[model samples]
Target: MTADDRIAITDLINLHGHLTDRGDFDGLAALFTPGVVYDVSALGGGELTGLEALRAAALALGEANPVAHHVTNIVLRETADGVVHALSKGLGIMADGSAGSVTYEDTLERTPAGWRITHRVVRPRRTPLRG
Candidate 1:
């Protein structure tokens, strides 16, 4: 990917946190494709497809949603199939001051609008077992 592509993708990932923390579900959903697949099964949310499903899921959280979201360590790679894969770390701070972290695996493609996530898998960050 070109430098501009990387910056755009990075900005897109960062925008997610801002939109979500602001409870702008509509803006958040705009970051993904219409037929996006969001797999949060590791967090017991199962898989959600489509922009409507994503918006519904976020709205369903209500006050349970995190107070803030921070994303870092974004690594993007392009595959032979012309899709970009992005892996990043996400830190979510809850309203109760509790925080949790997860790994966000995302697949994105260049759409007519812009680079949008087509699929994403949110996995809990596990601590390594003691030796």
Candidate 2:
């Protein structure tokens, strides 16, 4: 891939993180393929597919907790045609009245439309509030 290709992918993913954290479903869905396999299992993320399904999931999550997701350490490698393996670290600030941060690992790719997330597995980086 050319340098431009790499740059494009990086920018696309960063935008996605912004959309997700800001609860911009329309923007988020625009970055995916017709069918997106978006996973946010890191901090209550799961298999959320398609625009409609994912939108609902995002809405629910947004309502439950106000969030701020900052993405970093993005590494992108070409896997195959229209497919790439992207690994990035996401810092999620979840506000359940009170806010706390959690780190997540994400795997995503580029599609015909733009960049679309395939898998996002989150592991907590710090101890959360105990009930």
Candidate 3:
């Protein structure tokens, strides 16, 4: 990935994390298109869309559990509509110390402001058992 693409993708993901940590529903909802798809099967299934619904779901989840999301290994590719596909690994931390990590498949769109995520998917996987 080009340096600029990497930077843009990183910024978007960082902003998402920040919004998530702060429980900034309004801001997070605004980041997506009218019909954004959020798929984190660990939480539920298939596809999810609409910023309002997304915000509500996120807030509800946040209220139930204090958590942190960390992402890495971001891969960026340009899409036909000028959107950017960003793939990465994500780790989720809970308040009580329990944690889970997974591979995050995300797609972001380029806008006047910059890159904004249009879709996000996470496949949950348990930590490898140590010998």
Candidate 4:
């Protein structure tokens, strides 16, 4: 992958966190593929497919709409199929003043709309990383 590719993937990862925290569910969905698979089972939800399912899942599970999402430690790898795999940590500041953390295992592809996530697995972090 080129340097530009890496930058683009990192930006996409950051955008996901920003859009989700802002409760812009539709905007978040726009960042992914049409048949994107989102595995949130680690967060008490199942694998969600497509934009509509993603939107519904977010709305249903995210009763606490206003969240602060801090994303860090992004690492990316490009595969033979031209898809990029990104791993990042997300730390959320809940509306109720509680904090939660998860690691995002993402597969991204270069789409007509730009780089989009094709799959994402959200794994709850037992112990968050700090620096």
Q: Regarding lDDT, does 1 or 3 come out ahead?
A: 1
TM-score of 4: 0.88
In terms of lDDT, the poorest run of 10 residues in model 3 is 57-66
Q: Write the per-residue lDDT of candidate 4 for residues 1-131, one digit (tens) a residue.
A: 89988888888888887787766777875689889999989877889899889778768776664378888999998889898889999888887998888889999999888899999999987864688
Error of 4 at 72 (Å): 0.5
| Best prediction by lDDT | 1
Which residues of candidate 3, in runs, are more than 4 Å off? 79-81, 127-131
Q: Which stretches of candidate 4 lie over 4 Å from their true place?
A: 127-131
| lDDT score of residue 127 within candidate 3 | 65
Per-residue error for 128 in candidate 3, Å, reads 3.0
Model 2 ranges off by over 4 Å = 41-45, 80-82, 96-110, 123-131
Off by over 4 Å in 1: 126-129
Could you report the Cα RMSD, in angstroms, for every candidate shown?
Answer: 1.3, 4.4, 2.8, 2.7
Global fold similarity of model 1 (TM-score): 0.94
For model 2, give the 10-residue run with minimal summed lDDT: 97-106
TM-score of each: 0.94, 0.71, 0.80, 0.88
Q: Residue pairs in steric clash, candidate 3?
A: none
What TM-score number comes out for model 3? 0.80
lDDT for model 3 comes to: 0.74
Q: After superposition, how far is residue 105 of candidate 4 from its true place, in Å?
A: 0.3
Model 4 RMSD, rounded to 1 decimal = 2.7
lDDT, candidate 2, 1-131, per-residue tens? 66877787788777876777666777866566647665665556676667778778766655565467677887877765756676777665556545444443445565666566665555656664799
Worst 10 residues of 4 by lDDT: 57-66
Model 3 lDDT per residue over 27-130, tens place:
87446666778886676755667777777677666655447888777777776677677778877788888888788778787667666777888788776879
